[model samples]
Target: MSHASPAPAGITRRQALSAGAALCAGAPASAARRKPNLLFIHTDQHFAGAIAAHGCADVHTPNIDRLIARGVTFHESYSANPVCCPARTAWYTGRCTSESGVVQNDRFPIEPAMPDLGQWFGARGYDALYAGKWHVTGRDFTPSFRVLSHGHGLGEHGDATVARAAREYLRSRRRTDKPFFLSLGFLQPHDICYWVFAHTEPLAALPYPDLARELPPLWPNHGFDAREPETFRKNWRMGRIRQNMERWEEWQWRYYRWSYYRHVEMVDAHIGTVLDALAESGHDRDTAIIFTADHGDGMGAHQLWQKMYFYEEAARVPFVVSWPGELEAGKQDRAHLVSGLDVAPTLCDLAGIEAPPDCRGRSLAPLLRRKPVEWRDYLVSEAATTGRMVRTAGHKFIKYQGDGTEQLFDMRADRGEMHNLAAEGSSAGVAADHRKLLKEWEAHLSPSPAGRLTGTWDG
Candidate 1:
């Protein structure tokens, strides 16, 4: 749990002192006793296991590792709705995808009545500022935070530009009069989608050298599962049938994996830049930083290419919360199931502000303080309207709405999710229990519009 890493090389004494003074300046004596500043750093399509500190051996993420070492890491964190807009909406609104009415990507706008994270914090006198990707709705961000960046367009050097904007904000403009809630959203590994699209040509046709030895190995569960739900199978088949990427050999897949990790590393470097700025600004100790992703990418798992699936590689995300002296450090919480839905409520609770009335998530502030607290018995995640998953201590159950195809895995034994226990007669009772849990969860969801439920599966 010790964050004992060496300081990143090349930082100057003057830069550090100036940044620190800026953070501590102009604070009213009363404001000194107020809430800690909140820094929420979000990434797009970053797999939970891709970080070195999180058990992946193939990728290097020194920055992420340092952050993890300084905080409690949530090993079981998941995206409640594993798509871009839906998952992000859950993070901002503290509501499930169905409740937020954004069940898929680029389709549903958050209803005007619901208060987003920025509005909620801004109402409490925090200067809520947002930078980087804001895909929850259309271009107008006036109702949210004080918008710091515009559009989804990548800047020069991509994520580095986003980090530069954030660093500049911290260094030059951050207000010391009140606690600030800054959300930095970086887009990187999501670029792997463009990579896939632009690299449809055969590897032989490209000019790259053989990299078999340096490439990542295929996932143990790389082969297709016969018992995968028909809806998922159809989606996967359509992707392959359209792109013909199924013709890629093992080495090619390995190369793709290698490239994905490089993108992750690229984003990690930008993250380091922002973190360094925070430390230099002197707010490192007084700021609560929550690091997580909107969702995850498949990273060649199950021979899949992108997200929108309930698979672990796509649904689970890296979640870490660090506030130097206030929260426990260097700890990993593997006992409870956590989700993107918990972020807003947890931040509000830590800041002593009230979350919106319709927020569904429970606060993790008690747990972060190492206090005994009651927790939910099961965790639920949605995939558009086609799939709903329920995960408990020992098992994971996935059901598809269209054909009633079910997948049940004994997570304790088959963490790879290779075996299908739902079809087996002996495991029927466990599946039934999970079914009941899913039903109870569904009962709480507000009804989706007829069009939203029947839209094309565009993943």
Candidate 2:
């Protein structure tokens, strides 16, 4: 319940050790094993294709790249729900949107039994601390986490404060006996929401004429398949931003992409702050850093602007894990399917603890430690209460509750997701197979009941 700011600078060495001992007292026998400190860093609306480490030359993210060099990057990572609240709820609770009861942002609360990362880890002897945005809707982060920063607003102004708080907390750590789990909730390129709103109307000329040549081009799938499901088409036209973006010239879309990349660069610098502090505190090797995002932005893919749909730009996210010498460095786990739910379970497994009750996620600890293990073949991500995506290694199938039309795409062949293979008779069986897999997957989740959600938090 105490604030998680750095302890007083003048505390005696004896005092620090005493505090550590107090925190470790009465923990289970396995808790004495000096678990790795967890630095859970996540950004908002961060596209999987935005980072320089992931073959993305659009943005320079040296800090994220640094973490990539330190460990493995999961090439196939998707958010549980491609939005702020539900995806974050899945991350913190290790449950899907239905189980978490957070189908949309703040419209409903999380199921009471579901413990967020702060509550779950704190109860198990970690110094569960938090900074920046805690967008899990109904949960108040203070009671469970020792708060470092509560600033929740645009990334342009508030992200630096979040970084500073994390850096200070890391710098203040003088002992490792009690492992700390510091969650850095950075609001970034999410600020691109502001960028989109400000530019809803067409511009007469480029804002900065000199920088026009420096702009990154639009994504290849700028024009989309109009043969999408009824629900998918409905979401595409729901927002004013979408309606206005329809009028955007090709150059304007390029300008929007350039702005989004710049916003990413902005947050990358803030991440560098926390990384610098971790190293300065001499805990780099002992801390496991997990970097990801709640969801991703459209960034002109399929001429879309923000999340809600099951497009790759919105659903796929960057998931990286680093623990220095203990894990493989500079590698990509491209074969396995992963979800936002795996994060909480992986951290628990790495810390030698059991996951939360009914946690419907498998640990990625085996994959990270390079041990042989069977893994899940597909991942399901929910959207707008009823929209669902079942993704396998080669193909992705999408459906909505009320819409009879479904869409399936060959993800391996078309990363842009331009083709809807479900309409073809040859691929109908493949789509049916995914539907079966989805039904089987849902049978396992004892979904927490809630009223259906229809609103959009697309920004």
Candidate 3:
């Protein structure tokens, strides 16, 4: 197919042939009630706190703000595993890090039997197409998606190419009876990691001293709870950048934040183009847009530089689901706790298909459809090898294997997580409950047959 209307730009085996061919016998009659197309747009290292619409005053996100206005934004959603490969694996396979063997970035391969959304959807008659980043470790995007653009290394270079390709696809896509599942993996705000690397060493003076007044102030959690588990403390002091980050002057940290917000704005502009293209193509109403990130950047929170930590800055991400005129708009869902694990299940539910077997995440379709459903009371996120975080309605509990040192905080009163309530006698009951929940979660997992998770176990 030729894409000329504009730039806007995965396959799966067992997926060699089009499922649409099999459905042709029944497709003609159902042309009037066609399936809703799915547009799954994800970003890297973008936090909920970075968007202007999400109450952050740091940057202008007219595009994301508009998306929020057209959709339901979940303020409390989080990454399943606060790292690129693991979180994305959870998203595509609906499995936990342990189950997929992608315990960390570029570390391990996925279970062979696991089917990504592309393969699963394609088999069910959806045209599975992809553009931009596909960072699911060991699995080729070609096996699951029809590639649009492979995308560039840096968000500065790749994001525009991705946006243009997406715009072209939306504007000029061949109209088909079967719905299309287009997943656009954008690299952005994540580019701030490169910025951090460039400035690892302390500077004698601020690069733009005049802009000091404009740079955002350090996060309230800039000073973290020092009594962290070995998993977290080691992560803080792991690399040269992290070890040296603390010595950075207030201006330097603020400068880091100033640069991070710009990365957010950079992707926001491209997102705007994609949104405009969808509307211009007249598929805006019949399509559902699920926007989120694989994980979030530290943004200097806890004086941390990158991911692999369960700090709110790294774990928490923006999740917005929109289907214009079909669901409620401009609704902020701060009530339910959500996670990246929910991505696959929700998509399947919306398409009237049974969710993949043993899928760990709950579908938010009930909530989106205004159906009364029992919501999850807690959400879990993993970091590194042994780090585990269990977040309940009012508190967050963090622990690491073989580390007696644990941290707990009453999220309602101490959202900054500076205060440690784990050792306090008064909060022992809350801490115990959290421990039980984590144990139960671990018990339910049927871990991968081989790969990195094996080393994570100690008996």
TM-scores for every predicted model: 0.89, 0.90, 0.91
Ranking by TM-score, best first?
A: 3, 2, 1
Answer with 1 or 3, whichever has the higher lDDT: 3
Ranking by lDDT: 2, 3, 1
What digit string (tens of lDDT, one per residue) describes model 1 on residues 213-249? 6787777977766877777677765663335677877
lDDT of 2 by residue, 76-98 (tens): 99888898998898889877777
lDDT of 2 at 101: 86
For model 1 the local lDDT of residue 260 reads: 89
Can you tell me which runs of candidate 1 are displaced by over 4 Å?
1-32, 173-175, 240-243, 448-459
Q: CA lDDT, every prediction?
A: 0.76, 0.80, 0.79
**Deviation (Å) of 258 in candidate 3:** 0.6
Report residue 406 deviation for candidate 1 (angstroms): 0.8
Clashing residue pair totals per candidate (backbone < 3 A): 3, 0, 17
